[model samples]
Target: MSEYFIAVIIGIVEGLTEYLPISSTGHMILVGNMIGFTGEKASVFEVFIQLGAILAVLILYRDKFMDMLRPEKLKLVNYKENGLSLIHVMAAIVPVMGIGYILHKPIKNHLFSTNTVIIGLLLGSIVMLAAEKFAKQHLIDDIDKITVKQAFLVGLFQILSLWPGFSRSGSTISGGLLLGMSRKSAAEFSFIIAVPLMGVACLYDFLKIWKLLSISDLKFFAAGFAVAFVVAYFSIIWLIRFLNKSSLASFAIYRFILAGVSYYYFFIR
Candidate 1:
């Protein structure tokens, strides 16, 4: 297949899977294999193209980003009163950064294999299903009320995404719900946390493969990034609106089906 065609396919996969709690890294790996883009190039592409999704989040939440950087307006208020959600976000990022730093090479070598992806898909689906069932009984009603303790717990869960199939958004959001954060709140927090995490991942991957990249390769990467950004921006908007009125059960069901199908294709059948 042509490089441009492969780039477009990867771009589509990135846009769809990045925000859906289905593990964008897992999907990209699978798609990369099917499309004859494997090994280090595929890995770097998967991470690098995620900049598109990160940009989507920034554009969608521009106002929140601004508030996070400059909060002098509420300096007189208590920590919780000054829109300190951003600080909690920073706190939540620390564990994953530390863990990821420690395990980066190992994960890239062994944990990113197809078998690991399959297992991640299955296990993450189970977790999502259980979280959905729990949400029905104990729904969190407010996002602003999330405690630092709860944020840290959610961050811990987000660390699970270091595994190929375990989604960053799914684990963190589920953690938020379990900690009594409302679904919308959980989802929002999940989105917010993704910015720094994905940014770092993209940068790490690029630096790793910098010597291998060519100008033509950069063009393809930019094309993929642009496509992903447009799709992911709309997806973020739609997901937020849908979550306002719906349960996370739908995404849970989707994950289960995806996992089952992937297992069938890769192992059983």
Candidate 2:
């Protein structure tokens, strides 16, 4: 297969799993392995395409982004009084940003293996299943009403996603639910928080690999990025609507099946 074709396949996988309770990185690694695309360049490609996914989030939540910039709403006292503000986002992002930066090298070196990803997928699914079953109370119904305490706690939960298959949205949304947030509210907040977190991570990786990119590589990356953007935009919309009416049991079940398949192929076989 051509590099462009491989790019499209990887992009679709990235978009489909990026926001779902499933892990995008895990899917990418699995696909990359099968296609013989694993290496530093492949890792760089994975991070670059996330920018496309984040673009979908920004476009979907353009109103929230604009609200953060309005002159009247810029005041500290009025922050989040109008709607979800940048400050609230920063609160939820700070913990992960700090920890992620400090452990970036270690995580990249030690946890980027197929076995670790399978374990993360299985363990994270268990956490999601348990949180959905046991979390019965919903203290918050709107993303705007999320308290600082709740935001920080959600950030704390995001730390778990440093592992390959433990998804950022899954950990934070599960944390939000366990901390008394409604499903829709938690999902929305999870989406909002992902914007900045992914943006910085993408930028960092781009800088690291910028020197290695060629004209041919640009064409491939463009194809993947555009495909990821289009698919992720629709995926986010569908997921938000789905969360409004359903539990995450199906996602948890899918994760279990993925983990089993991965373990069989990578270890047992």
Candidate 3:
């Protein structure tokens, strides 16, 4: 396939999975490998394309973030009533970010492989199933009601997402469910936290690979970026609606199937 066509294909996969508790990076790695697009250039392309996905979140939750700028909104005890401020976002990201930073080198070098991603996919399905099965009863449906305690615990689940196929949304949503948030609420928070979470990680990766990029490559990157943004915009909406009436069981099943397919293709074939 032509490089631009590859970008579009991978962009669609990134958008469809990026926020769905199905691992976007895992899908990208597999798709890239199949399409003959794996390497440093592909890595940079992913980092850039993910930014487009994050932009959808920023725009969708612009009001919540804009509220953070208002000085009068952040009274000491209003965390439960003000929707989500920057504080909640920070709480959800710190644990993962700290641990992720420390382990970044080792993870990037050793774990970004099909074998490891298969393991991550299998493990993450269990996390989702367990979260649904043993989830707390008192549903904190509104993001406005989320507390620092809840957010922090969710952050800890995010640590699992440092593994490629572990799915940041999957891990953190399970954390949210286990901590008493409703599934929809958990998915919402997952998308919200993803803005900063993805932004920082992508920025860090971009800095490392920036010099490898060429001016001639801008169009390809733009193609992926634009496609990811548009598709992710709608996926986020569909997921929030989907969670309201359904459970994570289907997604877990999907992950299991994908993992099996990946293993058969790479190992058994």
Candidate 4:
């Protein structure tokens, strides 16, 4: 297959799985390996295409993004009284930024190996399973009621997502539930937090590999990005609506299946 075709496939996987707690990174890696796209080039492509999904979120939530940028909203009284939602989102992003910055090079160069992805998939599945068990017993009724402390703690949990297959959305959403946010709220926050975090990651990877990218490669990248953005916009909307009525247990089960399949392919086969 042409690199462009591979790009399209990667984009579709990224779009569908990015916000679903199914680990877009894991899917991309597995698919890339399956298609014989490996090593640094594939890795960089995976990170860069995430920009497409992040752009989808920004476009879909333009009003929220605009509100977050208003100067007056940054003031103490206004922020505390009316801007708390955006503020909490900002708070949730800080730890990930700090932690990601500190570990970016190490993660990219060393920790992003296939073995780590497998371990992360298995462990992350267990965490999701645990979160589901907890949610069955303790349900939070509202998303807006999420406290700053809770957001920060969720951000802390998001730190785990730095590992491939840990699923940034999954860790953060599960963390939010554990911290008392409703599933809908937790999932929403996870999507919102992804904007800046994934944006930075894409930009960093793009800059790092800029010299190696040809004009043709750029076209392939753009095609992939467009696919991811279009698909992710709808996926985000659908997931939020679905979570309002459905259980995350299905996702937990899916994760278990992914882990089993990955294990079988990597070890049993």
Candidate 5:
């Protein structure tokens, strides 16, 4: 396939999975490997495309973000004590920022493999399923109702998402659900958390690989980025609506099947 064709395919995968309790990175890596799109350029492409998804979040939540950016709102330290603000989002990003920075090289070099992704998918699936079954408190329905404790704990759970297939959305949503957040609220919070997490990650990777890209590579990146942005915008809208009346069991089961299939193809075969 042409690189452009592959870019569109991967972009679709990234957009559909980025906010759906599925790991976009894991899916991109798997599909990339299958199509022989591995190496520095492909890795950089993957990271760059994530920015598209992040942009979708920013556009979708512009009102909330604009409110947080108000000079008055910027003064707060913990927004949960007041209302949902940039502070709350920053707090939720703390754990991932610290942990992701320390482990960045290791994750890129070693954990991006198929076997690691399969393991991550299986483990994350179990966590999500268990969280749903055990959650006793489903009282917090509003995103503003999220407390500091919940934000910090959700950030800690986000640490697990650094593992390729664990999924930032999946881990954080499961953590929120376990901590008494209603399903819709948990999913919404997960989307909000993604903006910073992916923005920083994409920027970091772009800096590392920017000097190496050719014009062709740039074209591929642009195509992928545009496609991912459009698809992710709609995907986020659909997921939030779906979660209002549905459960995450379908995603968990899908993860299990993905893990089994990956293992069989990449190892057992």
Candidate 6:
């Protein structure tokens, strides 16, 4: 198949899975390996496409973000004591960004494999299930009401997502629930924080891999970015609606199935 065709396929996978509880990294690893697209360029392409998904979030939540950018909210330490602000999101991103930066090379070197992704998926599934069963609080339903403590704890959970198949949305949403956030609120915060997490991570990766790209690869990358952007926009909309009336239990089950299938295909085969 053409590389462009492969890019499209990967873009679809990234779009559908990126913000879902399902691990986009795991799916991309499996699909990339399946289609013989596993390599440096492919890795860079995957990271590039994530920016598209981040852009979707930025546009979808433009008003919330604009509020965050207000002059008064610009102070690094200033934030509403009870109301959500830029500080809440910062608290949620700091832990992962710090740890991820320290362990970047080691993680890329050792944990970016299919076997590890399977393990991550399985472990993440358990975490989600446990969070659902135990979190009866559901105290905070409004995103604007998220406390710094809650956001920080959620950020700590976001660290788990760096494990490739752990799923960033899964970790944050589960953490949010365990910390007393309603499902819809948790999901919204997850999507909101996802923009910066993905944006910084992708930009960092792109800087490292820019030399590997060329003008000839432009169309391939563009196709993947555009498709991922469009699909992820709808995915976000659908997920918020879904979470309002549902739970993360279903996604946990899907992770179990994907874990089993990925293990069989990649390691057992």
For each candidate, the alpha-carbon lDDT, in order, equals 0.80, 0.89, 0.90, 0.80, 0.88, 0.91
- Lowest summed lDDT over 10 consecutive residues: which window, candidate 2? 72-81
Tell me the tens digit of each residue's lDDT in model 1 across 174-255.
8877777777888888888899878887787788787777777788888888888888888888887887898767877776
| Per-residue alpha-carbon lDDT of candidate 5 for residues 1-269, written as tens digits (9 for 90 to 100) | 88899889989999999999988888988888888988888877888888898999999988878877877667765444567777778889998999999999998889989989998998999999998899758989998888867888999999999999999899999999999999888888889878877888888888988887887677888999999999999999999998888878889999999999888888888
Clashes of 5: 0
User: What is the C-alpha lDDT profile of model 6 across 1-269, one tens digit per residue?
Assistant: 98888978999999999999999998898889889998889988999999889989999999999988887777656676436677888899999999999999999999988889999999999999999999967779999888888899999999999998999999999999999999999999999998887888998999999899999999999999999999999999999999988999999999999889888887787
Candidate 4 structure lDDT: 0.80
* Error of model 3, residue 31, in angstroms: 1.1
All models, RMSD in angstroms: 2.2, 1.3, 1.3, 2.1, 1.4, 1.3
lDDT of 4 by residue, 1-269 (tens): 98788888888999999998888877887777778888767766777778889989988878877876688666656565563466777788899899888887898778666677877877888897788778533355654566677778899999988898899998998887677677788887788788877777778777887777667677888888899988899999999998788766788778778777877887789
After superposing all C-alphas onto the true structure, candidate 5 shows an RMSD in angstroms of 1.4
| Minimal lDDT window, size 10, model 4 | 135-144
Using Cα atoms with residue i matched to residue i, what is each candidate's TM-score against the true structure? 0.92, 0.96, 0.97, 0.91, 0.96, 0.97
**Mind sharing the TM-score for model 1?**
0.92
Superposition TM-score, candidate 3 onto the true structure: 0.97
Could you tell which candidate, 3 or 4, scores higher by TM-score?
Answer: 3
Q: Write the per-residue lDDT of candidate 3 for residues 137-233, one digit (tens) a residue.
A: 9469888789888898999999999999999999999999999999988898899889888999999999999999999999999999999999999
Candidate 1 lDDT (Cα, whole model)?
0.80
Worst 10 residues of 3 by lDDT: 72-81
| Candidate that beats the other on lDDT, 1 or 2, i.e. the better one | 2
Error of 2 at 72 (Å): 3.9
